[model samples]
Target: MPKVKRALAVEDLTKIAMYSDPQIAPNEDTYAFVSATVNDDNEYQSQLFLQKINGGEPKQWTFTNAKNSHPRFSPDGKKLVFQSTRSGLSQLWIVPTNGGEAQQLTFFKNGAVNPEWSKDGKYLVFTASLKENDDVGNQHEQTKEERQKEKEQQAKEPIVIDRLKHKSDAHGFHDDKRAQLVLYDVEKATFTQLTVNDTDHGFEDISPDGNLILFSANLDDDADYALTNDLFMLNLATKDVTKLTDGNGSYGNARFSPSGDKIACFGHEYAYSGATLNELYVFDVATKERTCLSSKVDMQLGDVMVGDSRMGYSTEGPVWSLAEDKLFFIGSDHGTTGLYQADLKGNIEVLYKDNNHVFGFSYNGVDNTFILGISTPTNPCNFYQWKNTELTQLTNANAELLEEVSLSEPETITITAEDGSEIQGWLLHPYDFKEDKKYPFVLEIHGGPHAMYGQTFFHELQLLAAKGYVVLYTNPRGSHGYGQEFVNACRENYGNGDYTDLMSAVDYALENYDFIDNDRLGVTGGSYGGFMTNWIVGHTNRFKAAVTQRSICNWLSFYGVSDIGYFFTEWELGKNLLDDPAKLWDFSPLKYAENVETPLLIVHGEQDLRCPIEQGEQLFITLKHLKKEVAFVRFPGANHELSRSGNPEMRIARLNHICGWFEKYL
Candidate 1:
């Protein structure tokens, strides 16, 4: 028998994101999207490409050597505005929609993002951060008298700095400063500051009439609290500010109706334990009464807006209809994210259903047409459009690159747990399947414990399948897409019940899929999945090898180390370390490390603020002390998102280490 070419070595995994932001032209006739391609130096460089909906060769738009993203079309559809770091810093740039030399719009030392055109198309609004008075550059230029006062203050005491990660999870690490809103006049080439404060104000939406700007911020309050984000409206003419939403909950991404009579926004009601579930809410500007539009949906709504003068909703990003009457959005329940359309009366209809993920929808108000971006477990993101109930593929972003690689299609399976609870999972067979032959298998777990592994594209899973392993992944208890009760099932139970569900999934794969080799089974996961990987190795030794990425080995240390440590531990474990140290340690994977005999590969990002590197360090140290087989691989300059959205090179390297470890041991 011919040996399966060691499924492309880990080093050969593409080191570039297959797709980026996909934006539809205002007219909806064509679309422009950014694609990151790996260059000769292995650096993933981003470039913009344009394609028509009916089908045609995608035309390359930008030829710069820098990264470009968040492409938006002007109201007239003649100009394209986007954010780029071509000038050493991220700034706004404008070019003709038909392609031309781009012009720089903002020249501030600080960067700008989220550029939106005014209704009249004469101005643009964006967000930026300016330096404060105490900054080194500002202090260096102070007058001699002012410098002497500063010197005297410095002599009084030593300066003490206290901070965890210098950057944030939302915007990565950078200089300490505050973000503010600014507007630029397109015709005059002038800029005007719209907001002035020390607090951060983001999630901006300008009214269709351009009379009021809506946003969310926690000014003069506890900025660190997640529940403090409230919607605020700024009158552009009088510079008057009004608080639209109040109370201890988050209200953001406010969008005004075409007539400016109603506002659509996403609200998150924070529970006592700090777990937030996003729901859609609409406020009648005249009555000042808020109505819950998506309370029955039981999932977060994103990208909400007034489309075609009708209320439309999306989760995290908006998908307005071409005629502006229908709004399309992605809603997830039971781990499946699908596209749906809703009207002003809160009536919703499913537009498309698939086991994959769908997002980034653009509507052409003129033609009543729309384009959407979709991807599946075995497919990378590609542009698709719905016409006459038929989905048409527009751009094959990674077809050529992935053509040489063989990918496996996941088989959906349902399994019964020890307690008779039914769970859902996917089994991806080896690329070359043979009857009566059993192949090694790997059980993969998703993080979030709250997050789910859906029919979405997972690069790591594909690599394992290519290496002759039947990969099994599941949406166990506590995973989203199931109802709220099912999602919160693992709260306080943690490693016990969830572990049983995963082990049950493994059993189902072995029994049902005759091709799965029971003795060569291995397991892996990250974040919460990482925690389970550790927990699994401790409780059982059925697998020959295991890989844990960004895992939590000690709940005690996690209570203080993570950014959301205090609240997360309290919510998941039912108590903080301070409240019940013994309880926190009782569920910790480190406590059961003595039973771990499976060869383990531990991976972590050096800069992860969620699980942090210490979590991996503790596990590796414990396993080494116990004389158990283990190896540690750390990715430099990567955060918790290293596996998902980290640098492409680093992501490939991380995947390679996992494949290498499994190949050697399993």
Candidate 2:
């Protein structure tokens, strides 16, 4: 008898393994990576795995129940350093690659992260949070008793805000501590502070000679209002700080060339505000002259494809070739992220690209090999090895679970807007679909009016398809993966071109696919997508049911409530509350809420700072006051990232609510 396959379930996420951050060892033959999966307690647990690129089974290197990621190999390939929460807070730990016990490396009070190895392997540089009066090494990890006392004291203190950017989505309220870099001498067991400032410093890379440390920070007194991040170098011995780039653009991910004579980075001047495409640049260290190497390339020079499955961060870089003449980095174009190569003369060429999503990769300059973290519509995530010109699959992380369950594969689609421009999207058929029956369709929109929805595996979209709904997701005019012109089309023109593009997608699907039911249509989206969902229901009655998540309703209140509202409103809408309140209100969906007739479900995270919960509450209360069909669901302790990296239990509940709403009305 053949094996039976079942439709995917919301709980299946626990069984699915996620792979990321593949780092090739110095030997060029072995590599290390991080694998994560949901535990029985509905918490995500990750560990490091080591394997050989030539041929061998992966060995479980760490057995901790907490997240152990950001693995970096030593220059001699003798040891591996990674950040883990096993010691309570996130801290760096080192373990021998051959096979040995892991040893704790740092014990900072606020924990340490972003570890980088010096060339001689004698010094390890990492970033840690420190107060203005705190010493680097003296502030060891606090004991449980001391931590509880500190927590109680902090709880009694009121948060006093003094800066425009006082809070963030990741860390709720701003504290006195700032991020700084520290050097750990492995031989002497002593720590040396490299930076001291109130503004947070981002660790980029250590030069080959280990004399200068590269970092990015806005040291201006009014950095809270500044939009650019300037690169700087800290001399390890003399403690002298040198500014590199001019104060004109935001630059980061800087790497020193082989000889440390040149520094390559990715950044862009805010010519178009937040929608500006990041370009590649090289700085002549001696003369301090900067040149744009990707001036001709019209693609974003980093992974911009939005996906929920990716967990850890991978260093997408201007990784130098041994000869120091060429550089390699990831670029997003035409709904795909691929590796590209460029030289000093501004010439560029494709290195590796396909229909799959290359979320992360590690390149070895010695033999010119690459270890890639790839994902597709049918596969959550897996590892692949690229040697010479051939590609080989390295790991089948979810093979067993995938074999037991059936998944829907999306078909590429193109829609022509009323103005004759083309919009790209993908459509997935209902599982076990038949041509004779018309199935209800759900239109899914993505956030980041600047982000793109591509070939990556999206669990939420798949869940809708498995529940017998034809799912349609698209990249509208403002989404990335298209050219700069297309992405900037919706800036300051919200609810104009982007709104038409989304409606055009629905029309194209209804006309092209006969299996979709026009009468029982539904729509849903989060963040900007959520904003559109609300806008769609108010502007038209085509959708019978709508689910708006982490949405924005009243632009007037949003201007003061949201974390990014102070600048994002002016940047994206070309209007601020002080400049033109009327224009911002004109683009808001709440202005037309009285026209909504469809049953709408408002979902929001209570702890969300990006699109604060008040955005949803105002819409719900207004709709209720108007006697409109509306329901609100709020997740406690959940932030804007709740749909992606929030509590696993909440993620499942959110998915259930979405499917239930469609089932009741669509």
Candidate 3:
């Protein structure tokens, strides 16, 4: 028998950062990635780190004291280009891959991001904001006059108004301006504007020959309507643009084949559950015919990397290795995310299998080696290089810090649903478990309804399990990593089948785990999970307490309030609000507010445009008016990502409220 650990303190969170998004060098001899580390002040700072494959120490490359990320090697692998905000704005910075003084490349008043070097290493393509009134001579005179006028205006009016969206926890918002493509010539040391106009173009890929550029844009479409994003090709020589893929669906991440004869991309037809099913398609440049590479393969395309001889793609959408016509990817079809290799003929084979989520993978054709970024429930992100079929650690981002903490590994469990479908879940018992004693259990749900909770290190889950609560979470129907059919099970059936799957998970925990107290049950989740929490409290009073974070209680209001509301609701709910308002109200948890008896705590961020605070406010107001036990907690200056990448102070406060609310009610 053992006792649960206490909640994580603010000081403990400063030990290490939960890092993802790994990119390897072209030579495969070294790799660079963004490593986030919490400072003594509890501020999370992301810096670039480089590690060699020869078992040397991992060295921190950048020391700008600001958030630096997205480190990628140049074509020659001599220089590393990245995006940083050390100059008070996020701009492109280039430093030698071996470590040297970094040089700032761009100095626009706006900012630059996503720097990709040309194959010849002569030009750099990036995205930046170019204003309509941007002119060297005219802007210089206008700035001088504006500075004098601003001083005079400030003297007359003491109130200086800020026009921007103020008080953002992350990168603050800006005006609704379009971002254009810009080409920087490394030899000429000059900047050339490639694309301009009111149309916004995003750079995705540059052809290996440097003759064509691939991008996604919303040109010739409704400015307000949420139309499909299309992929287009821009010829560098003539500046001629041609639409490659056109339809009523969004297309992005277009890559050129090694021979530059074909293009591979992944996108969905419409912006709904159908959009979630991303399929990989290839287009022959000369023939102008489209071929679906992942048509027969029922998996969501993650990322596709084309090589000189072959192309590789990930089904779960991380990273893949395509060399010599062999397609090596990471697949999650086996109930867990694992690496797999397949050929162009759709012949698939498992390369590596693990319970944890693989973030990124890279393969070197010259050395015949593969490098991967691996993480699990007990380990943070670390680099693992495969040589001669042996995997070795290349970088230890938080190995020392993790050794100081007592972390519990999650036990994988399978539960039978009402329809007899097996549901997968992971349970974390109290640090010290006593079979004879009853312990409180918290059922945590993940958002995306499309996102799966894998064997990864989750700070919030760890803190909850440490507080003497048996934490049980599962991927109900509509969660990814399973087949497309399983993910779409809750498409229009919101609270029907998915609800049964979640409840069955709780039932299994109670039936099998003897220490879980049935009377002291609690539930909490964000986004779609929040919707489930709201629906669960309304339908049954089995749980003593509940906390819903960034949730939607009413579908009808969410249609108009959310940023993607109009199209997302139409796709998932199967109709717009006008089509059937009754159906929207029927699935709304707030509609059954009168039946809610469990004491609930509603937490939301003020600036969340996804699930706006209005959703939480409506639930709070309705429950308060009904004389039910409920509390509302609003986090100011926070958005929908508050729980994951929000401000350190605010993220800790959010977890504290969840713990406090459950402790008080349960």
Candidate 4:
């Protein structure tokens, strides 16, 4: 008899392993990547794994129950350097490629991260935080007692805010420290400060000759308000700095060509505000003239697919070929992020693309081999080696767990809008789906109104489907993966076009699928999706229940509270709080609170600075005053990324609350 399969549970999130950051060795025979899994203690542990290109089970490199990511191989491929939090805070650690215990490289008090090896393998460049008055040479490791005292002192002190962008959803409030580049001599074990400035500098790459370091930052006086990153080259011997790109545009993730004659990067002018698609550019080192190589291509560069299971940062590069005649990068188009190649004359060609999400990759330009990190709707993540137009699986990190659980397969669909436009979406049937039975339906809206919903694993969506609810998610207007015009369509008209697109998708589903019960309809989303959920409930009672999370309800208050609210309002809505408060109020979901009759659940993170808890509080209070059917759930110490990377227990609880609410109402 065949073994029975069980539906995915909330605790299955702990069992799923996520893979990212693939780095191929110089010899092109082996590669290293990160595999992250939630522990029994409800914390995430990421460790490095190595495997050969031919085929074999992956060997674990690090044993620390902490984050070990951003692995970079040495020039000779004998050693690997990565960032780890094993020493209480994030620091750089180096380990041999074959075998040996890892050694700690940096002991800076403020922590060191994002280590990169120079082509010569004599120097390692990394980013470390330092106060304005602190010297790079004076950095020392603080003891446990000293750290406790500093924490106590910080609590007693008052937080003084003066900058427009004072707080971040990741690091909380601002401090006196700013990120700066530090160069370390591997043989001598000495450190040198490369650049010192009040503003933070992002480390990019070290030139092939090791005479210059490339970085990106805005050094203007109004950097606090400007949303631009300018590329800069610093001479190692003279300490002289040279600016590359014009200050009008933003650019980063630049890399020097093999011959060091040119540079490739991804950037664009804010033509369509924050919704502008990124374009590929190549700069001539001799004259500093920049050419847009991907101007003819209509796709957005990099992996813009939005999913909950993918964790950690990976390179989505404008990687240069060995001949320096071509470049490879990832592009998002038609709801799929695929690899593409471009040349100096603006010619493009598809490399490897399918319905799967290629989130991270590392290429060996010499052999034309690639180690790619891919994720699908049923699989959390796995590593594959691609060569000669063939793919060989390297690591199946979640095979044992996935074999015991039942997962839903998403069916691709396109919805036609009223304006004769096409919107892309996906529908997932219940895990225990039966064709003869009618099932409750749930519509999931992704945040970032600029982010795309694609072929990646999402734990929360799977849980809902496993609980016997048909799930539908779409990339409406204002979402990426579409053309520039489609992405910018909902910029100034948030609720007008985007709202109808979502409703039209729902209508299309009901008209096409016969197993969905229209009466047991539910809706939920976060961020912009959260705002839309609130708008839908206030405008129509079609949804039997709704859950709005980390959402924006009042533009007037959000403008002053959210970290990006000051500029995002004007960028997305074409109006600032100072320029036009009335219009901002008119577009707010709180304005239509009186019409909401459906049962609503308001969920938010207390520490979220993106949407802020006040946005949810005001909506809840207003609905309560009107005697509406509503409930509020607040997550303590959680930020905007609670759903994606929050505490494991909190994540499980959040899923339970959402599924429990739908089960109770629908």
List TM-scores for all candidates, in order.
Answer: 0.90, 0.99, 0.90, 0.99
lDDT of 3: 0.75
Provide the overall lDDT of each model, using Cα atoms, as 2-decimal numbers: 0.74, 0.90, 0.75, 0.91
Query: What is the number of backbone collisions in each predicted candidate, taken in the order shown?
Result: 16, 0, 4, 0
lDDT of 1 by residue, 1-666 (tens): 643433533554454245656667767778888776656666556777888777698888887787777788898899999888787667889999765699887666657877888877888889878655423122122344665787698679654445433345545544457777887888877777777766677846888788888878887444544437878888999999888877578776667766677777766666623334566677877677887666556664542110011011212443445344545666775546667776766777777767667645665556555577666765667778877678888877566545556678888888998888789887888876787887888998888877667666666787788888888888888877665667778899998888999988887877777777778989999889899999999999998999999999999999887877866898889998889999999999999999999999999998898898999999999899999999999988899887756776897788878888888987
Tens digit of lDDT per residue, candidate 3, span 187-278? 98777777776657888788879999988987764644646678888899999988877757787767676667777666777534452677
Cα lDDT of model 2 by residue, 96-117, tens digit = 8878899998899999998999
- Candidate 2 to truth, TM: 0.99
The 10 consecutive residues of candidate 3 with the worst lDDT sum are 305-314
Off by over 4 Å in 1: 1-12, 15-17, 133-175, 272-276, 300-326
Q: Cα RMSD to native, each candidate?
A: 5.8, 1.0, 5.4, 1.0
The residue pairs in collision within model 2 are none
